[model samples]
Target: MQGPARAVQPDEVLKDPQLETRARDLSKDLRCLVCQNQSIDDSDADLARDLRVLLRQRLVAGDSDAQAKQYLVDRYGDYVLLKPPFKTTTLVLWLGPLVLLLCGIWVAVGFYRRRGAAQGETEASIPLNEAEQKRLSKLLANERKR
Candidate 1:
């Protein structure tokens, strides 16, 4: 016996070639949330199966390829799409890495500045006044004569 209800085969889709192609293309780009890395077409999870059925129903109902995909997005949010659109809603998802990079640079700059300041302090020396220099030289000369 068959392992389970198998997918509608590509060969069997010859009756409606355009619909089959559209369904395939859309399913491949859509994600299976139940199986994170797997596309809707590839995953046999319940959610993926539901999406597959939904795709076929929409195709048969005369929704254009884009329209059907958009319909799913409307129901599930852009998270349903493999590559979610970049929008204000998704800005954090898209720009998270860049924000982290900028923060790291800011921290590094501050750390470097503080380290430099510490080094300057550690190596700092005060210059003597003219009177102090003269007194030091005279003391040295007196010691030498002794």
Candidate 2:
């Protein structure tokens, strides 16, 4: 079952189809401040509605799509963008996961290596068969006798 649909309201639709389409495309790239992960176009939160209306107003006011996006970025910072530009400020966001994965892989490799070495030592220390065990016992007995 799906949750209740929460998207653009009737009042939010632009009269111009082209402008509406553009607004929709732009909205998809914009993150809803309230929902964080959801695009404004997909959110029904009041803030999302406000952002949708603001976007349409910008388009109707003869702002280019880039200008409209930039205006929002200026107001909300790059967090408003779903795909924020790669920069020093967002370096962690882009690279943190990869670093974590590499660290995990390194740790796993080290653990396996240590485990294999321990197992190898354990195997080498054990007598392989009854004859080997008897030989080891004789060697120990001779050493004690000496």
Candidate 3:
């Protein structure tokens, strides 16, 4: 089995506990570009390590959490944020799943309605000719006798 994935390295940790905490919190919100679904804090990629170091450096340079995040956002676009702001540029990311689900539901309803209509048309009784009706009655009589 592989070893556990270590997120923060000992050397990358800030001397100040408070600053380290802030950095950790910030890291959790930042997305790892290499691992799109994982936060930088959770990723073991080199880029994630660099981002963690960069974040700590920013904190040491007296940049607020917001400012540090904005710096990364400026470089990487809103995709760097795990919870991206709902804006025109990112509209599709926010709404695409909902739109697709609604479209699928609409399609399924249409399919079912068409199927029901087809069944209804096929199930409509056709008037039998006299000979066929006589034969059907004879079959029913035979069934009753059995």
lDDT of each: 0.81, 0.91, 0.90
Query: Per-residue CA lDDT of candidate 1, range 1-146, in tens?
Result: 12222444443342576677777778889999898877887887877878888888888899998899999999999989998899999898899989999999999999999999998987676677899889999999999999
**lDDT per residue as tens, model 3, 34-124:** 9998999899999999998998999999999999999999989999999999999999999999999999999999999999999888867
For all predicted structures, in order, the TM-scores are 0.62, 0.76, 0.80
Stronger candidate by TM-score (2 vs 3): 3
Q: Order of all candidates by TM-score, from best down to worst?
A: 3, 2, 1
TM-score between model 1 and native: 0.62
Q: Report the alpha-carbon TM-score of model 3 versus the true structure.
A: 0.80
Model 2 has a clash total of: 0
Off by over 4 Å in 3: 1-5, 125-146
Q: If both were scored by lDDT, which would come out higher, candidate 1 or candidate 3? A: 3
Candidate 1 lDDT: 0.81
- Per residue, candidate 2 scores C-alpha lDDT tens digits across 1-146 of 12223698988888788898889889999999999999998998999999999999999999999999999999999999999999998898899999999999999999999999999999988766999889989999999998
Best by the lDDT measure: 2
Better of 1 and 2 by TM-score: 2
Model 3 clashing residue pairs (backbone)? none
